[model samples]
Target: MLSNPRTVEKTALDEFISQYKAYIPKPALVKSEPVGGTLSEQIKRSVTVLDFVGQFVELSPAGRGLCPFHDDHRQSFSVNAEKNYWHCFAGCGGGSIIDFWMKWQDVDFGQAVKELARTLLKDRR
Candidate 1:
């Protein structure tokens, strides 16, 4: 038996992109759905920012708190219930619920969808 374990090197961006593209279904093979309307409408209809955030971290009533995306001393994030949005005032920036998951988990777009889908499904019941 070999004493050392073999490890594969990281793929280059071009190679990675090519591999990702290969897995994407052709336009004819994919079904499309409309994501209609404003971001506010989408959030309001689907889920609240507080509820979404609670899936990843504990939050307070004012909607301001330490962001899960980065290390910080105080809570600087705020969520607008009526607007269905959030912003990190401590220089961390902010965006929609999907953006929060992407930043907090350091994941790519596809992973973010999967994570949110799973979370939302569980919440529904």
Candidate 2:
């Protein structure tokens, strides 16, 4: 009596993103240190690649690992804890955790934001 995973709900996505944006405290316009940074950096600082991946797949620890995006047993997906980044040695491509979620889930940018917001909030409380 089980069902397939449901598609991303648009209404839910909109509501969640709206709520999340509302909840976040706005940063002041005053310039201090570095004014701009890479979008990837923002995402990496916000969430770890491992935790982000876990939200999609159940990964087991292996010495090295295979690229989940391709068919290979060799462990090539290297996650740098210090850099908070992941790269597929198999040439599968790489980006921030948010990019991974978007690609893996096949969702739009807004939907991804909503999904991330929900996940972060759930983890916090």
Candidate 3:
């Protein structure tokens, strides 16, 4: 019997993953590529953080822009299309599109999802 609960859980999870590793794609792609498996997924896949951010911020030729969340001037913000995420080098915080929406709108997670669905899915319906 393993005394450490975390170790026991890890072992079980590792065994399960090894058994079904082929069933999963991008094992650690949770942050950028959310597995919502629904409308949110559509929203995420239909566009990228760079394009979304570009709608409001003026990005440079290389997709770098000033941070809007703070008083930045040296283009501390950058959007990575390959990773499908945005980040602020000035330590303002960073994450996926949903996180950006939440921060931009000054709203909570639920509000962010609702607004994103409304805006992004407006054309689908």
Q: What total of clashing residue pairs does each candidate reach? A: 2, 3, 0
State which candidate, 2 or 3, has the greater lDDT.
3
Please provide, for model 1 over 24-74, each residue's C-alpha lDDT reduced to its tens digit, 9 standing for 90 to 100: 878777555446543333433578877777666666776766776678568
Instruction: Determine which window of 10 residues in candidate 2 has minimal summed lDDT.
Output: 33-42
Instruction: Give the range where candidate 3 is weakest over 10 consecutive residues by summed lDDT.
Output: 27-36
lDDT rank order? 3, 1, 2
Off by over 4 Å in 2: 1-44, 54-63, 122-125
Clashes of 2: 3
Error of 3 at 91 (Å): 1.1
In model 2, what lDDT does residue 74 have?
A: 67
Per-prediction TM-score: 0.55, 0.53, 0.67
lDDT of 1 at 120: 60
For candidate 2, the lDDT comes to 0.65
Model 2's TM-score against the true structure = 0.53
**Which scores higher on lDDT, 1 or 3?**
3
- Top lDDT prediction, candidate number: 3
Write one digit per residue (lDDT tens) for candidate 3, span 1-125: 35665667777877876989887777565545435556667778777888898898889978899999999989999988789888999998888788899899889988887889888878875
lDDT of 3 at 120: 84
Candidate 2 lDDT over 1-125, as tens digits, reads 11432665768767768988978989879755433344333445667877666555445553235667888776677666566666778887777787777777888777876776666545542
